[model samples]
Target: MTRVAVVGLGMMGLTHLNVYRSLSNVTIAAICDADADRLSGETTATGNVEGTADASVKSLPAEVRRCSDLNEVIGAADVDVVDICLPTHLHVRFGKQVLLAGQHLIVEKPLARNSTDADELAQAARSAKGLAFVGQCMRFWPGWAWLKDAVNDGRYGKVLAATFRRVVDHPKGAFYENGDLCGGALLDLHIHDTDFVHYLFGMPKSVNSFGYSKNTNEPDHVVTRYLYDHVPLVVAEGGWAMSDGFPFSMSYNLNFENATVDFDINREQSLRICEVGKPIEYPEVDAKMGYDLQLAYFIDCIEKQRKPETVTLENAADTIRIVEAEAESIKTGSAVSLG
Candidate 1:
């Protein structure tokens, strides 16, 4: 069995813990949280861009060690995998420690606050004895995963044009309010679509972006157009400027030579494929969500002594670069080129 230690008890961290518990060959050996109350099983309902938090607030098993110190969890003899679900800025620090300790690491998305920090973590992972992965879970998400398969297998011919969007009400919390910490909505919220775009089509040649900020200078609302030679129109918009009453939504429309695929979280049947002379068809995806699949895949890789092909440190770093470029474009009012 793969023994896992989840560091953090926030919404994402709790979600990870619950998902790991459901997997057959995995065990939640330890849980660490800076908040003593959370470690003791006190939790307040917190909502994220993913929607209402359904994670149980119950206490952990008696066999599972609860730690308030990160070092304690890291040094424990039974912990094999250290999953870092801390804030964006702390990722590199704790990620490097996990790698150097000879423990397999899985860090939540945005890998690091910036490309420079991401590079540092990548270097550590390269030299570490254990494998490293970033939790860019959208890649494993069922709808997006199906799109990737269709593209790779040429099931949709070639992508002609595509637009992706993610919008949600502004998150009211200390971590999110501080742009320097979370990189605001652009990095925290939008990076999902940005990374998915990079996964679908390689890095764009250039990006032209426009943004608007409310309380902070960081871009809470951004629309970016990616320039690619083959694909004529490729764009993605992400923002958190919606009012508190606005429901979170994520949708995508991809037009291919032979067909078009659409996915909207608001729809009852979220995924559909349309083709000429054929009725619209809804695609059935696995009941397990991205969090479950990502953890399961990482555990399997650890047990098999293989590398994760989907969300590697290298690609995660590249996604940071892309986001940085978008920020630059938003500042300069000109398209930024990517190497």
Candidate 2:
């Protein structure tokens, strides 16, 4: 069995805890957080997204150790994997500590606040004895994953154009309000689509962006066009600046040579396909939350002593680099060239 320790009992942390409880081959070796209440099972976390698998777990397992310090979690002999779900700024530091302790590492999205720090963690991961993976969940999401395979396998022929969107009500809490810490909605929320865009089609030659801020100097709502040589059109819009009571939604539209794939989280049939003479078709997908599948993937990699190719530390860093270009493009009011 793989023993796991999860640090930071925030929204993502609690999500991870619930998933770990559901996995048959995993054991919750420890749970760490700065908050003593969470460590002691007196507090619980609620995420922005609804329908998370078993978010009702408020108590830690009897066999699991609870700690209020990262050092303790890193030093524990029972822990074979360290999952870092801390805030954006704390990722590199705590992640490095996990690597230094020779534990397999899984860091949450937006691996670091900036590319510089992302590179540092990537270097550390490269030298660590254990494997490393980043939770870029969109690549594994049911509908999105289907799109990836369709685009790559040419089942729908070549991708001609695409549009992606993720918009939600502003998250509660001061941490999210601070642009420096959370990197605004563009980096914090929009990075999901940005990374997935890169995953489906390689890095773009440039990015043309327009954004406006609601919370800080950073862009709160941004629309970016990823310029590619072969793909005629690729645009993504994401933000959390919507008014209160606005529903959370993520959707995409892809045009291929032979068919069109449409996905919307709010729809009854979330994944749809349309060909020239065929009626609309809804494809069956694994339909599992990306969060759960990503961790399971990491465990499988660890068991086989293989590196993760789906989402790597370097690839996560590259996503941040792409976000940086988008930010720059927003600031300059022009398209920024990227290699």
Candidate 3:
């Protein structure tokens, strides 16, 4: 079995814990959280965008050790993988520690706050004996995964234009409210589409963005246009400025030479392909959420002693670079160029 240690018990961390509990080949060797109440099973279940929350009472299994310190979890010899689900800033610190300890590591998205920190972690992964990856889960999400395959394989001919959007009401907490820690909506919400764009279309030549910052300097609402030579139009908008009652939604429409792919999470049938002179069709997808598949794939990679292809540190760093460029464009009111 692939022994795993998860180092947080917040929404994302709890989501990871529940998924790991369900996988057959993976064992939850240990769980660590600074919140003493949470460690003592006094917290209520938190919901996630993916709808994977467990509303039942929270409790640790008999075999799983509860740890209050990160060092103790990292030093545990039985942990084959250290999944860092902490806040954005702590990723680099704990990520480096996990790698230097010769344990495989998986960190949540944005890799780091900026490309510089991300680059440091990437370099550490290169020199360390263990494998490392960022949890850019959209790459493995079923409908999104299908879209990626279609783009790579040229199933519907080259893409002509693509537009992506993610909008949600502001989260209720200090961690999400602080623009410094969570990077506001740009890093926290829009990075998903930014990373997905990079995964599907590679880095853009330039980025032009317009942002609306209500309470903080960070862009709570922003629209970015990615310039590409072949594809005439590629744009993404992400924000958390919607009213409190506004439901979270993510949708994408890709126009191709021969067909178009459309996906809206809030729709009845979320995924559909419309082709010239053909009926719209909904494709079958694996029922498992991206979180489940990603962790399962990581465990398989550990067992096989191989590197992950989908969410590598290099790709994640590039995504971070794109996001940073977007932020710059919003600040200076000019397009930023990328390598």
Ranking by TM-score: 2, 1, 3
lDDT by candidate, in order shown: 0.88, 0.89, 0.87
lDDT of 2 by residue, 1-339 (tens): 999998888789888888888899899998888888776767776676775634443555577887887888895789999999999999999889889889999899989999999999999988899888999999888888888888888888888999999999888887888998999999999999999999988899999999999975689999999999889999999999999989999999999999998999888888889987899898776667899889888899999999999898899999999999999999999999987
Quote the lDDT for 22 in model 3. Answer: 88
Q: Give the C-alpha miss distance for residue 97 in model 1, angstroms.
A: 0.7
- Best candidate according to TM-score: 2
Candidate 3: regions farther than 4 A off: 55-57
Winner on TM-score (1 vs 2): 2
Ranking by lDDT: 2, 1, 3
Expressed as tens digits, the lDDT of each residue in 164-256 for candidate 3 is 999988877788888898898999889999999988888999999999876455889989999989888999999998888688889999999
lDDT-better candidate, 1 vs 2 = 2
TM-score per candidate: 0.97, 0.97, 0.96
lDDT value, candidate 3, whole model: 0.87
C-alpha-based local distance difference test score of model 1 = 0.88
